[model samples]
Target: MALYQQVTGLEPHPKSDGDFTGLNREDGLVIGFQRVDGYPAPRWPDHRSPTASHLLQGQRGPGGSRGRLLELGAGKPDHQPHELARARVLTDPAGHPFCIVRG
Candidate 1:
């Protein structure tokens, strides 16, 4: 996880799990990781992969700056009506799935 933080410039949050870890940036970007034991890493652009199951949602901020408000999973809030569902999924070096959603 330290190596991941170093490479991605994301900070590891205290809220994490044995099967997963949460990463974040000061600019409101949040990412999650899941451990796939005994299974090969997922391939990019492959929806069949386990990594593709993960989704990250974000909202637009004031002055075009992104905010740290999240509205999905765990104890997060519900999505607002103005929040656009423009989602784009991408994979990290470890084949972990992440996404960017603009509203």
Candidate 2:
């Protein structure tokens, strides 16, 4: 939540249920956190690994300027190419894996 505020300069609206918490932006970006047992970080460049999931890359700027990648997960692993064409994976602070691909 602090990082989201730092990056977007906007406060996140909080919502919770049981052990799960979610921070949301009006623009539809949602960040979720939950307590769970035995979560493992996904391996890099290996989408088949446990914890991997697909994410569509959002819009790019004019002249094809690269947009910043926002990953919501556990471990903060470095970005690596996925087995699928035109996709890359990154792990979040919570060890969740995301496969970011161009939309």
Query: Which pairs of residues collide in model 2?
Result: 73-92, 73-93, 73-94, 74-92, 74-93, 74-94, 74-95, 74-96, 75-92, 75-95
By summed lDDT, the worst window of 10 consecutive residues in model 2 runs over 58-67
For each candidate, C-alpha RMSD in Å? 10.7, 5.9
Per-residue CA lDDT of model 2 for 14-73, tens digit only, reads 666667765776787776656566666556645565753443432342111123434322
Off by over 4 Å in 2: 1-11, 16-18, 27-31, 44-49, 59-84
Question: TM-score: which candidate is best?
Answer: 2
| Per-model TM values vs. the true structure | 0.38, 0.45
For candidate 1, write residues 7-86 as lDDT tens digits.
Answer: 35577877888998978988778767666688777765555766545545443422211222221112222333235556
Error of 2 at 58 (Å): 2.3
